[model samples]
Target: MADGETPIFPALGAMAPDFDMPASRGRQVSLASMRGRPFILYFYPKANTPGCTTEACGFQEALAALGGTGIPVIGVSRDPMKAIESFADKQGLDFPLASDVTGAVTESYGVWGEKRLYGRTYMGIERATFLIDAEGRLVRAWRNVKVPGHVAEVMQAARAAA
Candidate 1:
């Protein structure tokens, strides 16, 4: 979990890390509350950034379809609650965008790790996604995510799981 080291993610079919964090709309989202329901939990580096916005908006566009499958998407970031709320409002994102200010949830999920940009090494949240079933088992995971067509791929997997 040190900076510049690759993260060790949870194994497939294992229980995902638990989380309880503040989110947009003045709500608190938690794994316990989401029990008995499948959900998509994604981790992004920052709110309102290009890639993050694209990913969030893509999920927004597919919200209805994802809703049909009875799976809700929750976005997580290490940004503060105020920033997350602003990003959600500016993007018109209907899904919950949880703020993990303490970095505990992101660390447990193995998304907060080393990152490099423009030859500068730093620590940040990796763009990742997890599909958890009703039983809290990890059904699928995507790490080092690329933006284009990613949401469609996730949607397809969600439908299949559904």
Candidate 2:
């Protein structure tokens, strides 16, 4: 979905694509390790940018509430490991930030796609979020997400699913 193709994320109730990727703070996250626990996978266009910063901080602020409810969250972007590290440190983000440098994960999630800015068409990752149940099936998805109050919405749905 990165070049003029229609965006299509994994269907609800379908198994999420498995992945083992490097994360910030010298950590690694894999779908296999996440079995039997619900988690959030959010994709953003870049690291340390305005929108991304707001979104990441929003998640950081809500982590306490989400953690008590047993839902973990991971932020993903096509940035290099260094960038993610810097961003997390600057933003005080306590959650994992996965680097999808190859764009494989973004493509599988259908969040990487064409975009137009200033009348110039280009490829980028769409701001999207996927809520995966403990069974590894996606229960909900928010494509082209608007940052304001998005994490609250996710928390509400996650509480219900959990």
Candidate 3:
């Protein structure tokens, strides 16, 4: 890898980067706490935005099925706690939503990068999802995600991982 080059997203079977961040449920969460259980860690750009909301609701809808299989789901973004709390309430999302305010977690996971909107380029998080197995190895990654049918796909993978 060249200088300044971000490592490519962690491949299948790679160990997930550990993170300890403030989650919306009023406590800190870390990858170590999730050990021995498969979970999905999804990153989005912001709270309450159209696409972000859609993706969040999709996960909420799938929570029952995902939980039934003993797989947990977590959503992460750079949004502050207050904003994340409001978004979760407004969207009726029951999963823990972590605030990666400093971008360390996002950067370590390689989802923070350049993005373009209306030809204006800037740094932001790329919507991505990662599935980590019971032992904390990343079993799947979905980057540059499209909202439609995404939760279903993730659920499929989670089911298989179990």
lDDT (0-100) at residue 72 of candidate 3? Answer: 89
Q: What would the TM-scores of all predictions be?
A: 0.95, 0.94, 0.95
Give the Å error, residue 121, model 1.
0.4
Pick the lDDT winner: 1
Local distance difference test scores for all models: 0.94, 0.91, 0.93
Query: Which structure is stronger by lDDT: 1 or 2?
Result: 1
Clashing pairs in 2: none
Worst 10 residues of 2 by lDDT: 1-10
lDDT of 2 by residue, 1-162 (tens): 478864377788899988889998999998898999999999999999999999999999889989898999999999999999999999888899999999999999988889999999999999999999888898899988999889889989888877
Give residue 159's lDDT in candidate 3 (0 to 100). 94
lDDT of 3 by residue, 56-137 (tens): 9999999999989999889999999999999998988889999999999999999999999999999999999999998999
RMSD to true structure for each model, in Å: 3.3, 3.2, 1.5
- Each candidate's number of clashing pairs is 0, 0, 0
List candidate 2 stretches off by more than 4 Å: 1-7
Candidate 3 TM-score over all chains jointly: 0.95
lDDT of 1 by residue, 21-55 (tens): 98999989999999999999999999989999999
